[model samples]
Target: MKKIIVVAGLLLTMGFHASAEGYQVNLQSTKQAGMAHVGAALKLGAESMHFNPAGLSFMKENISLSAGASAVFTDLEYSKDGYKHNSDNPIGTPFYLYAGFKIYDNLAAGVSVNTPYGSSIDWGVNWAGSRLVQDITLKSFSIQPTISYRPFEKLSLGAGLMFMYGNFSLSRVLIPAGDLESLRPFAAAVPSLGQTLDNFKDIDAASATLSGDAGVKVGFNIGAMYDITDKITVGVSYRSKVKMRVPEGHAEMNYANETELKQMIATVNPLLIAYKKNPIVIPPLDKGTFSAELPLPSNLNVAVSYQATDRLLLSGEVQFVGWSAYKALNVQFSQEVLNGYSINAPKNYENTRIYRLGGQFAATERLDLRLGAYLDESPVPGEFLNPETPSMNKMGLSTGLSFRPLERLSVDLAFTYVTGFGRDGSYPYVSNDQVKAFGGHYDVKALNPSFGISYAF
Candidate 1:
C-alpha cells in the first residue's frame, strides 16, 4: 500500500470563520433579534449602531442606553455510510452594550461594545475523525464610536470607527497513529513512497498534537437612511473587512505516546547500521512558536421599512456578504526548517445573500410585539465544509416582545430557532493544492435566546 503522509505546515484555516457573517452573534439587542434584525430603516437610538448607525438620528429620547446577551446552543451530527457521530454543544455567549445621546435636534452620537463575530466548536477528546479537529474557539469584540447627522428633514447619514479585536485558538490531533506496529508497514513503504513517508518514519517523538492562535484585527463601518415617503424609508450600510495578523503562536505536545516512536526508531536502526548507511536519526521538534495571517471578509446591507397602519409596521432587508474574497488560507511558521513550509487550505467561499421579513405591533400603550423569519444561505461550498467548520445554510423563526414597566424603562426579550439543511459532501481529489476534508454527511441546528433592557432619559 502507498503511504500517504500529511504535511506538518502551520494551519491557515484558524482565521477563516472568526468574523463570518453566518457565525456573527446577533444578540446585541433582543429587540432586533426578535424582529429578525429588521429595523435598519425605521430603527432609532443606541442599538441602531449595529444594523445601521444612521437610524440613531430618529431617537425620541435625549439619551438612551441598552445592554443584553445571547445564549447560543448548536449541534452538528456527522455520518458516514449510515453510522453517525454527534458534536458536543458548541455553546457561545455574546454580550452587547450600546449608548446613544442626542447631540442636537438633528444629530446624534453613540457607542457600542459587542461581540458581533465569533464561534466555538468542540468534537470532544476522541472521535472517528480526530485529525479533523477536536475543538475551536474564536473570541472577538468591537468597540464602535459613531456619529449620525440628519442634514435633511427625512434623511440621515452615519459613520463609525470599529476598534476590533479577535483572538483565535484551535486544537487537533496531528498524527493519529502512534504505535510502532502501525508504523512498520507505513515505514516499509517509504523508499518507494518518497520524502513524506521517509520523514514520517523520522517523526518527532513529541509532535503528535497541534494548537495555536491569531492575535487581533481592526475594521470600520458606514451607513445611511432615507425617507421616501411619510410612511416609507430605505437604508444602506457597509462594513469594511478586518485585516488580522498573528506574529507568533504556540503549539504544545504531550510525550505520553513516545513509547511507539522509540520502538519504531530502534527497530529501523539496525538494518541501516549493518548495511553501512548511517543509522536512523529522529528529527528534533525543538520549537514551540509560529506566525500566520488570515483576513476576514466584508459586507453590505440594504433594508426598507413601511408603516402599514397606525398600530403596525412592516420590514424587509437584504444583506450581501463578500465571501468571494475569501479564496485561500496562508500561513508562515517561525522555525527555520518550517519557515519554508505553510499550511494552506482552499475555501472557495462564494458571496451569499440573506433575506429577512418581519413585523412589529403595538399591543398597548406600553407593550410591543415583534415576529420575523429569515433564510441564511451558507457561503461555504459543500466541498469546503471541513471538520473545523461544518457551516450550512439555514432558516430561522424568531419572536420577541418589549414591555415598558415605566415611561423611561423598557425590557426586551427574544427567542430564535434555526433549522439547518444537511448534506453529504464527498472528497474527490481535485487539484494538487486542494486539500479535502473527511467525507461525511452533516446535520446541524441552533437555538438562540436573548434578553435585554433599555432606558431613556
Candidate 2:
C-alpha cells in the first residue's frame, strides 16, 4: 500500500508541469498575437494592460475595450520500443478581456481577465505509458486591476494586482494488469492464493483519479516604458511568481478485480501471520483526500519598437522565464492506511528564454497587416522529461490583420503555427519499491486561430 501510494504522488507531480514550457498559453490579444505575442513596447491602449501596463497611459482614447479568444489545436506523438501512441487531446480555448479608461491627463486605469496557463493531454486509458500518466487537464485564469502613470511626457510606469486561480484533474494506472505476474512466486507458496490469483489473469489494472481546486493567490505585474525618440520606444516588465495551494483535494480509486483481490488477501493472511508480517489493508476511496502546492513561475520581458516609416512599425522582445523557482512539490494524503505518509518530489527545472520579432504595416486607412516569429526554449532537462508533459524547443510563426468597420471599432484576426524540434528523453522513478524508468521519442505541434474586437472612443 505504501509503495502504491507513493507512485500515485509521483504521477501527480509530473502532471503539474504541463502548465509550463511549451504549454504556457500566450493568446492575450489577437492583434499582439499576430506579432508573435510581442507588445511590451507598443502603445496598445487597453491591450497594453497585459503586455505592458505602462503603455496604457499613452492611450489616445478616453475609454478602451478589447476582447478575444483562441482555439488551440495540439498534436503529440510518442514512440518507444516498437510501440507508438498519440495523444487525443481536446481543443483548448484561451481567451482575454481588457478594459481601460483615462483617469486624468497622465493617469490610466484598467482591468484584465485572461487564461494564462493551461493544457489538456490524453494518451488514452491503456497506452504503453499509462502507468505514468493516462490523461491530465489543467485550467487557470487571472484577473488584474492595473494603474499607469506618466510622470514625464517621455516616460510612463505602471503596476497591476494579480489574482490567480487554478484547478486540475488527472488519471493514471496504479498497478498494471501485467505487473500482477509478480505475485506468481507468492501464489505458488500459498495454493489457495494461487487459485484466487489465477482468476485475475485477464483483469483490468487498478487506476486512480485526482482532482483539486487551488485557492486564489496574489501576485503583481510592473512595467516601465520610455520613448527614446520620436520613432523609437523601449520597455521592460516583470510578472511576479504566484504560489497556488490546494487545501483539500479528492482522490478516488478503481479496482477492476476487487472480488478476486479480496479473495487473495484473505487467502494470504494466514501465511503472513505465520511469518509475523502485518496484514494488508486497502484504504477507503470515499474518504481519501490530499493537499499539494504548485508554483506559476515569474516572467521578465525587455522590448523595443521602431517606427521605420509613417505606416510601418517593427518590434522585438526577449522574455526570461523563471522556471528555476519550481524546485520541488510536496503532496500529503489524509488516509489512515498511509500512516501519515507524504511525498516530496524534486523538479530541477532550468530557466529558459524566448525571443520574438514582429512587424505591423498600415496598408490603408481602414486596414492593417502584421507578421511575427518567435523561438521558445524548453526548460526541462533531457533525462527528466516524461510523457505527462513532453516538452521541447519550439518555433512559432504568426500573421494577423485588423479592419476598422467603424471609426471607433476594429475587428482583429490572427493565426499562429507552432512546431517543436523532436526530442528523446527519459524519466526514472521508484515503482513497487524498485527503480524503473520510462523513455521515448516525442513530437509536438499546434495551430492557434484567434478572433477579437476592440472599441475605443
Q: Report, for every candidate in turn, its global Cα lDDT versus the true structure.
A: 0.71, 0.83
Model 1 residue 227 lDDT score: 90
Model 1 TM-score is: 0.86
Task: Provide the lowest-lDDT 10-residue window in model 2.
Answer: 1-10
Task: Give the CA lDDT, 0 to 100, for residue 32 in model 1.
Answer: 81
CA deviation > 4 Å runs, candidate 1? 1-6, 9-22, 177-181, 184-216, 255-286, 427-437
Cα error of candidate 2 at position 147, Å: 0.6
Instruction: Write the residue-wise lDDT of candidate 2 on 278-333 in tens digits.
Output: 54445454376788887888889999999999999999999999888778778887
Shift of residue 243 alpha carbon in model 1, Å:
1.5
Reference-based lDDT, residue 253, model 1:
56
